[model samples]
Target: MAAVKLPTQRLYGTSFTCQISERNKDPPVGDEVWGTLVKEFSDVPDASAITRITVRLVIAAVLGGVLGFERESKGRSAGLRTHMLVAVGAALFVLGPLQSGMQIGDLSRVLQGVVQGIGFLGAGAIIIRSAQREVEGLTTAASIWATAAIGVMAGLGMEVTAVLSTAIVLVILAAVPHILPTPSETDSKSIGDD
Candidate 1:
């Protein structure tokens, strides 16, 4: 009995099993078709993957910048570059698992780590003005947290969600102060009455 040989090809550094009959000198039309399809679909060039990653990073950075710009306009210490870096870093954290082909469950762990890490950074932004009995930078810290979330959405390929979230954030940051008076303003109003 003649032993049948199977053709194999490498994809992403892994070989795919190809079954073909030995009776024919050439591979069957189906095998040839399959081989061509595999080469076309499975052999993604590294440059293409890099481009996708770069795009995601850029989207994350832009979304973060939008929020950062609003905070910077208010003269907050943690402004454009800080928010951009936070968003880019968070997106990369999510992207790492995706590029490695990690399962969703594993990806959740990475996301959890990203959130926890951002919490520490947000904490750094918060300051208690004990003499004035006031807390400052809370809004800036919250914006930082939200920027990270936008990055996560962008990295997960939810560009619409990221954009919408950023829009809502900008609206809140820009409009809320005008809608409600600040503590100092209220205090001054009361002092003027006295």
Candidate 2:
């Protein structure tokens, strides 16, 4: 009896024969694009995939900037650049793990690391004045944490969620302060009555 031959699949314009002997063979040389920084493990990304990645990164930065702008306008310590960096860093962290062939279960661990790392950065922004019984930079720290989350969403390809979250964060930063009294304001009011 004769064995039937199986069809081969083409990758990067090279035919990958499905023979058991060929399974361990390396991919053909000259198959990679010369200038791309990212190397695809399973398959090369076409122009569309590259464009999508670029778009996601840009969106992440812009959304982060929007939140950063709000913080900057309020004269916060962790302003535009800090927030933007956090977002971009978070996006890259997720993107790198994904591009490196990490499974979905493994990806969750990467995200957890991002959250925990961002928490440390956020903690650094906080200041407590014992004598004045005042806390500063809490809002800024919270914003930084939020910006990281926006970046994570962008990295996960959730563009709409990232954008909408940015808008909502901006609204909270801009409007909520006016609706609520600051610690100083409350203290002053109480002192004046006394």
In model 2, the runs with Cα more than 4 Å from the true position are 1-44, 182-185, 188-194
lDDT tens digits, residue span 93-138, model 2: 9888887789979899899999999999999988876676657788
Per-prediction CA RMSD (Å) = 12.5, 11.5
Tens-digit lDDT track for model 1 on 1-194?
35565778898999988654556667779999999998877533688787888888999999999999888988887899999999999998988788768887878888888899999999888877666566778888889999999999999888999999999999988887788776577673221110
Point to the candidate with the largest lDDT: 1
Report every candidate's CA lDDT: 0.85, 0.82
- Checking candidate 1 for backbone clashes, the offending pairs are none
Give the lDDT of residue 56 in candidate 2: 79
Give the clash total for candidate 2. Answer: 0
Scored by Cα lDDT, where does model 1 land? 0.85
